[model samples]
Target chain A: MATKTLIEAIREAMDEELENDPRVFITGEDVGPRGGVFRATMGLIEKHGPERVVDSPLAELSIIAIGIGAAMADLRPICEIQFADFIHPAMNQIMNEAAKMYYRSNGTWTVPMTIRAPYGGGISGGLYHSQSLEALFAHCPGLKIVIPSTPYDAKGLLKSAIRDPNPVLFFEAKKGYRAIKGEVPDGDYTVPIGPVNVRRAGDDVTIYAYGMMAHYAVEAANMVAEQDGIAAEVVDVRTILPVDREGILESFKKTGKALIIYEDNLTMGYGAEVAAILSDEGFEYMDGPIRRLAGPDVPSVPYSHPVQEAFMPSPKKIADAIREIAEY
Target chain B: MADQSVDLQANAASEQARPSDSLSPEILLEMYWYMLLSRRLDERAWILHRQGRIPFHISGMGHEACQVAAAFAINRGVDYVHPYYRDLAMCLAVGMSAEEFMLGLFGKAEDPSSGGRQMPSHFSHRKLNILSMSSPVATQVPQAAGLAFGIKYRIAQQLQDPEDETQPRLALTSLGEGSTSQGEWHEGMNWAGVHKLPFICLVENNIYAISVPMHQQMAVPNVADRAAGYGVEGIVVDGNDILASYDAMVRARDRAYSGEGPTLVEAKTYRPVPHSSDDDDRSYRSRDEVEEWKRKDPIARFQQYLLDRGILDQNKIDEYEARAKQMVNQSQSYADEAPYPEIAPSLDPSSVYAPVDK
Candidate 1:
């Protein structure tokens, strides 16, 4: 095993897949020469050649549409959307075309394609770059959404997503690309798409989070344990759509209190769905109402660092919510 | 004054350009048969829609000649097609049976396209390499380009063996004139042109997008004129003339296979009927205009060509029409008696999103 950043892990996963399968190729703006905007694909073009690592035009709709078309022709395409904020322009292709290809064709055809996008706040990317739109994508059926919190999970889940029979939306947490580093296995490995990982096991309360918020949830859980003598369990909900329902329920059954955290807005974010899931299935095991620590309902992510920090769910905010639920 | 005279002369030249007789008698006869069959099926579908037997109906009306001609020119079962809604003739020519069309029209379980999931005219048959279409207009343009890219890449890598054919496989995508206004169309065309991919873009210029007229929708007089900006060959054909459209498609396909890049073929046609059963042509168009277009009906024009060439007698025409009508009748009855599929337990929302073991 070797220590690596989340971005390095992603690059390694694509590199391995490209070398393993001839049908696998990467395509997006600047994915060929410049090695992507964040350098996630730095050295892929030289290693795999320009045919596999394509540099597409500045058109998101065509980028994803071409990927769907190529996938239909039996090629495994890994499409990068540059940023999660730019994915909206290609929503029709992703939600309507790619997602519905298998179901609409009655399983006669499938789009085994993966779309990766950097998402979340904390780097002050402002409105255009810092946005968590997982809720909009998770609402779509026939599409799996994967959000990894660490380098290990990032590489494993991305590899599995590229190999999945169905289309997958792999959202890489921009905040954790370099900041969150861990030991990733040297050889091939894949984390299953729809399973939860317990970052910190405890009994007093269950803190559900994923992506960038998973790190904060663990920090909050640790803080609550040392300061307030409360044992908080942090459950990283890896895959958003086909959520780890059993894992969440099992964790809730032991803790009897749930605190959901996310960087997206609270109105209809993924946390709301988690809250609903708990209320519907784990009500009998709950000791009090499910508490949520999430970004407020704002029009857009602010540009200023202080405003952006305030807009996201920090560890202090999560710990306070956890403490309130633990005491209740 | 000189430019006006030149324009008038060009119009006169186009009017004098008749359907080419280069195609063999057998091919011309088959084109006539498919055109007649498409018209008969469309007429029956509209009747069924009016009788409340079907929920919706979209007519291909005056575009049958172009559709059948283009389909005939392409390599079926090898090349890919991303056809639009008004491609009944194209689908039929590409090996979709009349029974399949009827099943789709009735939204029956036996429908090959979507099995009662999508509306009729959204053609998709895996065996024929026909791509599935969505309701969103012009969304298939970029997809066709991508498919062409895949075909080119595979052929280069020797992943797909060319089946005894000299020319490489290409992708054919069709759309209406109004759909050209969509940004996806431009993006797709630009990409194909830049890559010089084996792709063909066919625009069935019927002069209307639902209720919007062509003049109000586009700044150019002809949709093919836009191809110059993309650095691809553009040609205009008489959509009412099967031979003309067939010849144009043959040239376009050859150019694509020869590594000359993509081509845009604009077939100037008209929509004789309303866009759909729910639309009323009288609101946006004049009855006289529709009646005038009926005089140049593609099926009638092709019949005249056959008669003039002495390839088909009046009795033969009657027999062919009867055969087409009988086929449509049998298919409609079969689809009407077909049962709907039983709802599967897995279709439930609770089970659909349930976590599965890895």
Candidate 2:
């Protein structure tokens, strides 16, 4: 097992996939010689020529639209939206075109393309730069949303997402790009797209999360255990699209007290869906009220330090929520 | 007389569909047949809508000549076509059967496009290389550019010349003049021009976007003029004239294949009927205006052209019309008998994403 930062592992996955498949190519603003705004695709152009590693213009709509077209042309394209906040311009291309291509064409056409957007609030990017839009895209049924919290899941899930037969939205945690480091094997191993991993097993409550929040949930579990001796289970929900329903239910049924954590606005956030699913089918197994710790319903994540901190869900905040839910 | 004959030869060479020589008289008639068939199918669709057999209908009344001509000029099967809703003629020419069109119009179980998922006139068929259209206008333009870029990139990867006779094919996308105002459309054109991708964007300027007239849509009088913004060649032609449309499409196709990059073609036409069955032209437009454009109809103009050239007479024209009517009738019967789609599959969340659930 080799230790790699989240960004390095993502670059390794793209490099390996690009080398293995001639059909795989990447297009985005500043993705070529500039590598990427985040340096996720650094040196890919030199390794695979300019034709494969294209530097697209600063137009998000066409960036995703062209990827859909290229995929229809039998070439697998991975289009980067630069940042999650910038992906709003491409919602039509993602939800309308790529997501529905196969169903609209009655299984005749399929868009085997992956859209990468760096999401979550961190780095003091203010309102425009730092945002979590996975909840927005998660509502789109035909799309598979993947958020990786660790370097291992980032590389493995990214590779799997690139090879998916349909459109997959892969959102990386901007806060965890370099901050999140984990051991990753140096080969062709891939974590399947639709399973959640239990980072820490417990008996009191199930803490569900993804992306940067998943790491926070793990930390909170450790904190609650060390301080209050609360054995909390941390479930890293890697793929939220066709949610690992069975795994989530099994984990929830095991620990009836559920605590869902996400960085998006709490009302109707992705965490809400988890609450609904629990209430819908897993109602009888409930022991405590389903609690959610997420961003407040603020219009934007402010640039001011205090406001930004208050807007973001931290490990301590998650630990407090876990403690409350466990006590209940 | 000799000078006049030479001028006629030049006109024929410049305007007619290509075969290294002028199109054979039979081939000209065949093109006319597709136009007539498209018109008949469109007429039947409107009647079905009126009769309550279908939910809605969008007519390609004045667009048949340009649509079919463009398809005929390109290698239909090999080249991808991202067509707008009003492209029945193009779909027919590019290899979709009349029954298939009717099935889609009726939204039947066997409808190849979506299996009744989408509304009528939203054409899509994979084997024919017809890109599936979404409701949002001009969204297909960027995808069309991307498809062309993919083809050219593959050619570049193989180290082959895109200018060669048949190595890399281009993508042909059509939209209404109203869609030209969309940002995605501009983004697509700019991308195509920047990459010098083999792409052709066709604007069927039918004067209205539903009810909003072209004057309100954009400042430019001609949609082709916008091509200058993207550094691409632009051409305006009378869409009612099949020969002119085919000639322009052929020239654009040649320019793209020769690596001259993309082209913007504005075919000035009219939508004689309302935008769709749901629209009402009487509210905004005058009957005289509708009648005026109807005289410049693509099908009637092409029919007259064929008759003047001795390619068709009253008898042949009648025969073609009869065949088209019979084909439409038969298609209607088949669709009428076809069953509606099963609601379960569409509702099932499993098939929503490919490769089934993980």
Best by lDDT: 2
Report the lDDT tens digits of candidate 1 across residue range B1-358.
Answer: 0010112233322455433446788878888888888889999999999999999999898999999999988886568999999999999988888999999999888888877778998888887888899899999999999898887777766777655363338999999999999988998998899889889999999888998988887787888889999987888877887877887788788888787899998888889999999999898888988898899898889888789979999999989989998999999999999976557832654322223336
RMSD of each: 3.1, 3.8
Model 1 C-alpha lDDT per residue in residues A144-242, reported as the tens digit of each score: 999999999999999999888778999999988889999999879999998899999999999999998999999998888899999999999989977
| Per-model B-chain TM-score | 0.91, 0.92
Query: Which whole-number lDDT from 0 to 100 does residue B353 have in model 1?
Result: 29
The parts of candidate 1 lying over 4 Å away from their true place are: B1-22, B162-168, B349-358
Q: Proportion of native contacts found in each model?
A: 0.54, 0.77
State how far residue B321 of model 1 sits from its true place (Å).
1.0
Quantify how close model 1 is to the true structure by its C-alpha RMSD in Å.
Answer: 3.1
- Give me candidate 1's interface root-mean-square deviation: 3.2
- Which clashing pairs does model 1 show? none
CA lDDT, candidate 2, residue A126: 92
lDDT by residue for model 2 (A163-223), tens: 9988999999988899999999897878899988998899889999999998899898999
lDDT (10s digit) by residue, model 2, range B1-358: 0000112243443554454247788878888989889988998899889999899998888889889889988888668899989999999998999999999998998887778889988998877888899889999999999999888877877644555544338999999999999998999999999999889999988888888888888776778878989988888877777887788888889888878999998887888899999998899888998897787777888788778878789999888888998899999899889999888887888877777334
Candidate 1 docking classification:
medium
